[model samples]
Target: MCDILVPLTANAQRIGTEEERKLLDQSIQLCQRLLIEVTLSEATKLVGRAEYEDALPGSIQALRFSLEIYGSGRSELIPCYILLAEANLGLSRFKQAEECLCNANWILIKTRDNDKKVKSILYRGFGRLYAAQGKREEALRQLANDVSPNAALTDTVC
Candidate 1:
């Protein structure tokens, strides 16, 4: 089930013909009903294993599916963005990672979401991204933000 749904959902995002859009809509519906959690979990595990290349498609699929379900700039999409950032960071794709983190930050700002755990994840991702880029001071600042009790309220990553 996951094997089939994963590619279907991921590829549907590309070929944007009218027929593909219809297929994408159907795929999104199926993903929401059944495969979202499974796909995300697999993607997370792949990232945990440092298999960034393998994880990208699943992370992307999860992000698109979340977008379909929650709309843009919703807090619900934060985790998917974070996961993508993590994968990109692992792969040394710094620009892509930064973009993903920026997207998450924008969503946080737009939604005014105050979930500390989510903010922690976002800051941690930024910390790692900066660290990977050899920006020591920025890395430390982001890591500090990740741990600071009031960081969620004080920091805006965008």
Candidate 2:
């Protein structure tokens, strides 16, 4: 499953009331439980309402747990790296995000998933990192690549 951090962050931004905050906390806890013992759509659902920085540690832990359960050879690795990169980006940890993105890109390239949706994620991650570094051109390039109509080409590297 993919972790769409931007949407998650946007949803989390709606947390203003104490009741909403409590619900978010409960969702986070449920996500942790699901990640710890079982794979559940509930966990993915919870992710959409999670604050990135706040969810970073748990997301990383969830990925590790998934890797452990599914074995290192499984295909869950790419999304794990993507989640980590997005979390790091949310925390303004550009270097960590870049490193994670590098790993994610490597996985994607190796897997040869010709899916632009996955490629777009990698590009979006890079765009965030470049934007943080004040590299406007690089950021724009990455963002453009993310939304490019024909990102199926090999040169469409993030």
Candidate 3:
């Protein structure tokens, strides 16, 4: 018999039924086992908003917890890095943010779905990091790569 332990978060604690609980438990088990692919995009917007509102520690914890459970291979995980990198950027941890952006870029490169969009996000993130580091040329290169703008892209700093 394979015994699996899936750590549940506060968000996973509010289901109102046994069946839902069972399903969530199973899903958590699969996540811990790395048998299910969890995408970072599913939760990033909420987390990012939380960060923007100065609720970053919790948001970062949620993302980091998810990353630990999901094993970080999915394309959706790219946004997790990006969001966390942004948080780090806020903290003036530029090197850490740069590393996170690099990882996001690698994930974007390997992703098959919405490559253009993913590349654009990665480019924008890199641009932000480069801008922070005073590398204007590098920042411009990345900004130029971001041609197809999404409605979500409001801040030009990124």
Best by TM-score: 1
Q: lDDT values of the candidates?
A: 0.83, 0.67, 0.61
- True-vs-predicted CA distance for residue 144, candidate 1, Å: 0.8
List RMSD in Å for every model shown.
Answer: 5.3, 13.0, 9.1
Q: Tell me which residue pairs clash in candidate 1.
A: none
Give the per-residue lDDT digits (tens) of candidate 1, residues 10-93. 653356789987886776677574566876899999999989999998788788778887789888788888889999999999
lDDT of 3 by residue, 35-140 (tens): 2222234235544564443534434554565566656756656656777677777667889788777777666555544566666677777788889889999788
The TM-score between candidate 2 and the true structure equals 0.64
**Residue ranges of candidate 1 with Cα displaced over 4 Å:** 2-30
Off by over 4 Å in 3: 1-24, 27-55, 112-114, 148-158
| lDDT for position 4 in model 2 | 32
Candidate 2 residue-wise lDDT, 1-158, digit = tens: 33633333343554569998888766655554466433323333344565565556655766766665565644567677777777677778888888888877876677776767778878887887899999999889888878778655534344
Best by lDDT: 1
Report how far off residue 147 is in candidate 2 (Å): 1.9
Scanning candidate 1 in windows of ten residues, the lowest lDDT window is 6-15
